[model samples]
Target: MTRRTFLRNVGLATVAHVVGCTKVIPELAALTANSVNSNTESKSGKNKLPKWKGFNIPDYFQPDPWYEIKHTPEEYFKWVADWGFDFIRMPVAYPTYLNISPKKQFISAEDVYKIDENKVEQIEKTIYLAQKYNLHVSLNLHRAPGYCVSTGYNEPYNLWNDKSAQDAFCHHWSFWAKRFKNISTGKISFDLVNEPCYRENINDTKSKTTAVPGTLYHNVAKAATEAIRKENRNFYVIAEANNGYAAPELADLNIGQSCRGYYPYEISHYKAPWVYPDPAYQPTPLWPGNMGGRYYDRAAMEEYYKPWLNLVKQGVGVHCGECGCWKQTPHDVFLAWFGDVLDILTGNGIGFALWELKGDFGMLNSNRSDVQYENWYGHKLDKKLLKLLQSK
Candidate 1:
């Protein structure tokens, strides 16, 4: 979900309900498509990850159950496999599957461990379906026990400092690791958290959100990694980079790292309602134009990625877990900027997953005004964008 949608759905939890397509595959066929294998530790001593390309499945992204848990249709999976994409990152909201209080208030320390098996089964079904299509699933907790980058719901405790929250956070990861322990690491991996950043007040939407200290971030991630390993040592674990778009700090551990592609916020989030709160501040984006008081272009992009590139040189596995422009940007500008983004990432042997597959920033039904879309299987396909992504 985009920042706009998350903020809009913050207080609608009471009325939220499950809604989505009910299309189901009658039979679970044997895996016909080739799933990418997990790479071993590199000579640099960091675990290596496959340079997989695909899209994010926001099934459980919204924490308040605001959107459908499984919005992507089965046919979309077939299309992803047919298009040569090999990855699907599912951002899960823990609240959607937890047995929260009837009032649905902030989960207290005593109430955080209750498990709702039925909702969890729904998650498992979706993962297996994606796997059936030969797509490696990266299960991520977009909303964890005590923190979420999106300031929609109020978490009971601060994950960075509260021991209670940290325990609960580790509990959730352990639950998932045990739940899918039987699955092969090649078919699925666990992303510990999504887009973690430092927020003095997590419930205050207007407060400053900055990067957490490297040591604190490392401690939380290391604890969570140990939690997952205790349940199943073979479970491949990934810790999203601190502050989402920055370089990862957990190179001492065997877990992989995930990064973001939404650099130069002016381009990726141009005029996005949640981003540009004041319309007068939203500048018309240009590929090589001056943005945020600097000349922005491919050279600037290369400079931006220098830290990530340096991390890869040290033998750490890295992937762009979320990258794409909001549909508000002009189509031509989006393509030009995104083309460079893809080129730089792929040229460095890194892979990326577009923020979504169907809505807003996606390959189908993006609702952008400037693109001439092609009709494919009754869905409007962004052929130009697709060609660009497929080429990478």
Candidate 2:
């Protein structure tokens, strides 16, 4: 079977498992609620920075061959600041900041991993702009030297297996640490990697091993963290949970843990071009409805977040680094889920940055067919979702 077909089968199997174990939903919800309440009191006065509530600036630095800046950094940063967001998660592609061309034939690993000075200057400018606008920026390496979640690119080495790739990864973070050593942790932070994971079933034992010591990803993260600390001890490090940030590992690192909020993938990613789950068998996604013998609803959403809540209880700073449904999802349904998710995150004092600011899954300016557009920076704004997002 093709990769898409295999993934579709996996999705169907997941739904089957959820349907078969229907009784666990309420149990998970209760656990989440209790954990949220207890952790609220326990986590008091832990970190002085306000919980991150913001949007991701997508397509700015990823997928290489840089795209033209649609909106000026000043415009975007000011917009985020004026909208009351506390931070902006900038997902950057490593190649854009490197000296070597991605297509270049590297004679040696050293040639492959050189940091580019001009690119560094450009990133420094962005940080300065963010500081001027009073917005906290989380610099994230979305596409590192040897790995990227996106397809179509030929990465020469596997970040998980190649020693050179791992060293290069640490070197990149270390360079940034020294470059921005003066920036305060409250104003700038490092998100070690974006959505670190292997393509394994969520419940697979091998996937669980990513959290254990000596695992490739964990080792890389620990090494990078130590490398950054070596330059700037005050820098805040944010680590994403493995497997789409769903698995509850890496809390022991004592750094902030970034979690994803794309639960019930059928609903959040319905009809998304990038997601394929057997179009022949995929059911239309709906909030609080039955899907293949399983009941899916707000409570199920709460259940999905239980693991992250548990991590929060462990005193690890938790942030939903990426969360939001596709624009194609019915606007009302999207709002219902979004509101419930915000309620959960805010109630638990867990912060979140929506999937984007102006693209698909965006709150401020989205390209959903259902909504009437009001042009802002060449894109249309969804005032309804924007208002809801800013609402208490």
Q: Per-model C-alpha lDDT, please? A: 0.75, 0.64
lDDT of 1 at 186: 79
Candidate 1 wrongly placed segments (more than 4 Å): 1-47, 65-70, 101-105
- lDDT per residue (tens digit) for residues 114-169 in model 1: 87998888888888889999999999998888777674577887777577787788
- List pairs with backbone clashes in candidate 2: none
Candidate 2's residue-wise lDDT over 1-392, tens digit each?
10011122121111111011111112111123222222233554343224788878754454434233343457878887888877788888776666766454232456546678887787778777877887788899876766555543445665665566667777788788988887676788888877654433322312222321224445567677777766666567888766543434454444677877777777777777657535556667667787667888878878878777766666667778888887778887788778888888777877888888866778655667888777777767888877877883
Count of steric clashes across candidates, in order: 0, 0
Best by TM-score: 1
Range of the 10 consecutive residues with the lowest summed lDDT in candidate 2:
13-22
Candidate 2 regions exceeding 4 Å error are 1-49, 64-71, 102-108, 199-215, 245-249, 277-281, 375-378
For model 1, the local distance difference test gives 0.75
RMSD of 2: 9.8
